[model samples]
Target: SLSDRLQGTFDKLRGKGRLTEDDINSAMREIRMALLEADVNYRVVKTFVSACKEKCMTSEVLDSLTPAQNVVMIVLDQLTKLLGSTESKLVLAQNRTPNVIMLVGLQGSGKTTAAAKLAYLLKGQGHSPLLAACDTHRPAAADQLQTLGNEISVPVFRGDGKDAVAVARDSIQEAVDHLNDIVIVDTAGRLQVDEEMMQEAVDIKSAVKPDQILMVVDAMTGQDIVNVVREFAERVDFDGVIMSKLDGDARGGGALSVREVTGKPIKFVSMGEKPDSLEVFHPDRMAKRILGMGDVYGIIEQAQKVADEKQVEDAERMLLEGFTMDDYLGQLQQIRKMGGLQKMIGMLPGGERMLQQAGNQADESQLTKVESIIRSMTKEERKKPKKINGQRRKRIAAGSGHTVQDVNQVLKQWDQMNKMMGKMRQMTQVSPKGKKKG
Candidate 1:
């Protein structure tokens, strides 16, 4: 995992007072290799590393903190920025009765599945959506949409013997008559983006005046996805993109390349085959996941959304005050309110890597044990772990259905961390006053 690898890279310099040029260079080298291994484009990685190195060169390292961690954060921020620092929403014309969304891609790009997923997503938000099956060429393509529509409880419009343009026209009229707010038109895809497919897609767009033309590409297709997106965008001038099969073990360079090539925002990501598996595209979260950094910023944003101002302020205060066991447990509850631990981690910088590592090391049983142990502690014991001695540890372990050794391990790790922070404080007080590090 990226976090474990990064943590290992900086483990030797954990208590160091400052970062030298050599430290930055060594860390950057490792990061560069990691990015390449993750299948990031070579040019993109080069540019990213150069920018990160420049920032690291000018960055001051905090006393008693690993310069490598600081560098990691810098790289994480840059990665987020490179991926487009915000979520991409589907564009809809304000005064338009029905928002026409045309989906285009090569054959087997999951266009039909994506269209149904989009409809399901829009319906969840209280918008009545209609699915248009413009793919009359492929065998059972319209039937596939009809099946998905039945599952999602949305209407699917299709016309036998009608061309793609005529199908789109009829679907838009049906959407308006039914008072549907959005129309998702799934077009026929070819093995390649040839002149015929291009012209047909353009004709449909011309007929319907689609508010958004989204190019769908399979993430597992690698760099070829970029070429397909470019060809489609050139022909029909798409408004956004949709990358499917992201749940698979794809390196995801295709996403970066497609975005770079088409200059269009990715509106949605299909993680699975299910109709509800579509997510509004968030570039920052994706980038952080790729870099092996947990999406800390994303967590904060979600926490702010669901939590009241006072609760959010309190959590922030606790985090700034050096989190304790009680605070940790409280945070767990708060995080649960927003989502589960795995989900929260997925939103963090290098989150995917951290979750992978954490999952490998500690199974669900371990998490259950940890939660139970925390629950058994008295309020005072949680706030002040120094109060937990041999007898208390034995009592807590027994109550939580764990062994004494398990309880001891948690305490030992916490104590070590406290000692390290203490050393960091001391180092800060003795170090030079003018420079503050990342």
Candidate 2:
């Protein structure tokens, strides 16, 4: 949406090899409005616009042959800088064997969920993490943490009922006893301005002396998040932020506004409720996304993490030999693991626009329907789909609860996919280090 908005604003400047103050003024006005509409803090937008305007005024930008491109470049560069130039890692201490991390946030901000997600992320990074339930204020908070811990196969350190401070202190020893190299403490969520809540967080910090105190804030809170972060920084003093409910936020620029406004980097974003949906926040990738360039690197990285090596190799082998309905079903499962179709599209350039073009056809639910259709077929039918005549096609349509045309559509799609995979397999076999082998 930001890209579309900017496109109209920059249309006038497109042919101009050199930009005057009026051109810069028109562009900055649109940019400023776009950022504000995206829920970025007002002061942040003002500063960002001013910085971009200053760069446009430079002689080099004025003389550049591709002045319009240069203007876009300036915006991207400023956005990346505003978001924090480099990826911010959750700071861990080398001297400490079990790095303790305390998660703090307001009520319903997803602190408990973020803890498990972070553990899942850290476990993937080769660290054995233990979840510590230190949120005694809420009912059954310990049980909730234990459930999440079970889901991730991470150990939980739950102290005897209603002693959050004791839990915080005891979890350290539990980490040592279990040989968990990291401890993620889920603290009770509270309002930033609440004195009682602030004191409790302070007490726990004093007791555990955590390596990192990350505030898990709801990204959709917009400018309210800025005030909350400022309040927490003044009192509890968090090291970084973990933006939760990120995927649901339509106007996410406010979350990005925190880094510039509060001098704290956003270390992670909880994109979805799934344990594996947490991603390390990369500013450049986010900037690219806002500019409609897509986050191809992040998408590929996610694919690498979830892609089963053996399954993929087997699929490739099958593609070279012959593809079956079973192979097609397996590929569908793999795409689900890679965060479904919409996510895949979001990671590619012009993906949102493409989704708009696709209407309802590219909906993630289609994967389910396709999988159902494949499953409705018998094993013999799955292996040799060509053998299925009119009668069997009707039976599969009945079984999958779809129209006969749907079954035909699925068959057609599989046929096309099989051909494409065959081509890919041939290319890979013939190519030698990206060159065709003679």
Candidate 3:
């Protein structure tokens, strides 16, 4: 969406060898509009566009990028810096037995959900995380967290009382008792920021003396989120911010403004509702995505998280030899581990454009259908798909609850990938000394 609009602006200046005043003016106007339309805060959009314009005007366009691409690069650079240049990790003290992190935000900002997500992430990193339900005000806040904790297989700590402060204080002992290296305290939230809410947050902070107190802000709120962040920062003095519901189709302009205006790095972003949907916020990757330059590195990181080294080596070997239907299923599984097709597409540069071309086939359900079709096949047919004659194809389609055309589609995709992988393997061949053998 942002990519298409910006590309339209850049297309008119295609013939220009260098960025002239007129070209820069036209480009900046388009960029300004694009950012604003993307729901970026007005102040942030103004500052970002101004910086990109100034840089493009003063500096020579790099020979590597086209005049249009050069200006895009300038914008990308500024946007990256506008969002934080690097990842802000949730640091824990090595000396401490249990690292406490308190999550605070207004109601519906996803504070409770974010807590479980954080625990899921920490648990993945080999830390024993205990979820502390310090949210006594909400009717089912504790239950909601407990459900999430159950889903993630993490322990929940809830003291038998209405006092959130005491519950948080006692969670430390709970953490130590459970041998949890990390304790995530999910605090109560109100419809809006009020004195009572602030006081409760302050009391939790005072009682727990958390290692990090993160303010959770809803990214869809745009500029209004800044006010919430400011209030929480002033009242409770949060250590960092965790913007939630980023997966939703919000302009995400609020995210662009949060760090610059507040002077706090966004440590994490809640991408989806699942416990595993939380992702460590990487500014450069996000900026690249905004510019339609896919995040290859981020995709690789996610892939690595789900795939073992042995599996990677085996996949490469299989690709070089001849990937089978079973191998095809394995590849799909790996992609699924990396957050499915739609998410993967977002990380690729020009991915959204490609998505437009692919049409409805890019949906995650397609992958599921493909997996079902593969599973319906016999082991012999999977190893040698050519054995799957018309009757077998029909059987697979019927078993997978799809038409024969869908099964045919799956087979066609596998064939394409097999051929492509063969080509890649051939092109990558080298001599013993790592030089081209031919």
Top-TM-score candidate index: 3
TM-score of 1: 0.76
Stretch of 10 with least lDDT, candidate 2: 429-438
| Model 1: residue 249 alpha-carbon error in angstroms | 4.1
| Candidate 2 lDDT by residue in tens digits, 196-259 | 8889999999999999999988877867878888888899998999988867635357666899
Candidate 2: misplaced stretches above 4 Å? 1-4, 7-20, 306-337, 356-361, 364-438
lDDT score of residue 132 within candidate 3? 91
Q: What is the Cα root-mean-square deviation between model 3 and the actual structure?
A: 6.8
lDDT of 3 at 111: 93
All candidates: TM-score: 0.76, 0.76, 0.78
Off by over 4 Å in 3: 10-17, 62-65, 307-333, 336-339, 353-365, 368-438
Model 1 whole-model lDDT (C-alpha atoms): 0.73
